[model samples]
Target: MRDCCLLFQGGTQLPSSCLRDEDVVALFEGRLPVSVNVLAHHHAARCAACRTLLVTLAHGDALPSDSVPLALLPLEQGRRCSRRPSVPDATWTPPAVLDGFRLERLLGRGGMGAVYLAQDARGDRRVALKVCVALQPDERALASFATEARAIARIQHPNVVTMERVGEVDGRPYLVYEYVDGKSLAELRPPLPWPRVLDIAVGLAAGLRAAHQCGVLHRDLKPGNAILEPDGTVKLIDFGLATFVGSGGTAPRGVREVVGTPRYMAPEIRMGESATARSDLYALGLLVFELCTGRLPPVRRGACAAFKPEAGRGPAALLTEWLPGIDPGFAAVIACCLAEDPSERFAQADVLCAVLEHVRRLVAFQRTSRVFPTPWMGAGFPPPKDEGILAGHNVF
Candidate 1:
């Protein structure tokens, strides 16, 4: 791979120079060093050969144009240049084989890449294959993809999605994840039962705790990123926006340039601050709110301003109004998770998990008591000989 940076003399026309095949492969496979990434971007802008190579690597076809979005361009001196390059008009076509995995069908596509439901020939198991789209092949996007693989690999928990392998085929980087046989929480219609919601919340929190223990911060946590298995197990998925705590810097900030979903983003994140474990907790709080009320917390967007909190009422009040029988403790936990100040929220995912577990038990006890009330013990009944139902139970 080329190690030298390409110097540009400022012109809109294509440059006379082109990238080497090795350098193009390295860039698409996310193997390029930071320095080469900047040079690759500059050269890709003017060299149709490099652009077509990237297109072929991403989609197995040539593109009509090679206009790169300004957002995808690397920031120079922490600032984005004003020039807009033409983005290539390309479409993705799933390849039959990637490495040893046989692609069964395209699962979905996102801003970063496309996912395929694939079969691992060697292991004889199905997996979700995520291939990085190479339309622009920006360094940041490649870095994010690599970060997700590293993050998921570090976390091994039943509630978190498992990564089997990561490899590049035909210059396209891809990830193999344990295929989940269920729908995302986003697909579940709201007005979900409180018990069911709490069950999912507990699992999600546990997963987050596991990730946090590994120093991986899942900056993006939303219903769409959580899957509900057939056995009621909730698995957190999509760590593309995840970052390590103290990993040097946060995402670049600008108008509509945040990395996470606006509705679930913490206040600090909305304010362009680096996301910490607490930020994940805040998103969990929002997920809980959405599950209970069938809607996200209200926010308003100005013409040029970021999203601002617009809910006139506290979460507890809104929750109580929506579900009158909701547990006060549960409501309080949600409130704490949504605290504007990171310090005010739950210190860790485990803390939130413990509280949610307790609330679950309380709800279970209440339901059981209602169903099987201790028959009004008569004077002779002697309080039913202390049935031991509440025995060994820790009073919350």
Candidate 2:
């Protein structure tokens, strides 16, 4: 212990009595005395082992080459002592006015940006102001941001949030969208009534259909991206990951990386394949399943055939077991949307919407007839038949 202390004190009597690990750590952390620091530096310059130890202690790993001098390396004291500009807290005062809009309170925030509830002075309407605050925007992120604006601008639907305009404030790209005075579906307490869930599902599908008609694909669709109005109207929001397809527009530029909420992503998307309209339908199916059962279905592995039952039952049987009380017709629609093979799923969003609308009408009719028997059915009316609900329609 005495020898170790002496070595840390920079005694030059015994050059081989090198500094201890504690001393090395202290020196790296700038905790060593000034005199000892100078002596330690001089000793480290001459000793190969001491130099390697100092480099390791400072950087947590050995450098590739020892040819670099110790003085040139970044030290703890140098980094701490250097003055750096303070980053302003944007939420503190926020801006009084940005691009002619009066900034109000923050709505939400994500990895790439923050959304604020703002009032458009010119239009006298409230709008959601989304600003990209990334210090350095990568090619993919920039392309996606621009793509979102273009995607929303091309589609006009009651069930989809509308973008008013886009502009830059202080070099940050910001988008203004029609503000939705409602909560996200994710905020809803679980076990929402099936009727209300069906309503939301119908609206979401309609919005997706509209987007699809415009040759747009919402790559990321989930409960969190859906806003539910007081009147049970669901409006789909956030097209940051949307891409265009077919003749209406070009595919998302520079979007090579897989982009979507993983849990809601389709099997093909999870496997790094390009997202199609069917992929969006798959995500919508997951969203509907969550709204119905307040939970996600069991993960499907490998191929769709794996989910097939030994008795030759369809995949819908699997979901029926997990979500009791769910209408068999509705469950079957969801299962078809979640088909591992895109070809097995609804070919278009409009077709899925039509099927869902029919199911909703049947469910409503059954509920009404069960409570109050119609005159045509005497005292009791049998529940509506599901035989013709999907008949004569090319769903697959």
Candidate 2: lDDT over CA atoms?
0.65
lDDT by residue (40-138, candidate 1, tens digit) is: 676656544444445544542211111112223333454232223334446345468878889998776665578899988897689999998766566
lDDT string, candidate 2, 36-134, tens digits: 677777755544445554654454221111112112222342221111111323332347788798988888865456789998888768899988766
Q: Where does the lowest 10-residue lDDT sum fall in candidate 1?
A: 381-390
Error of 1 at 207 (Å): 0.7
For model 1, what is the C-alpha lDDT against the true structure? Answer: 0.65
TM-score of 1: 0.68
**lDDT on C-alpha atoms for all candidate structures:** 0.65, 0.65
TM-score of each: 0.68, 0.68
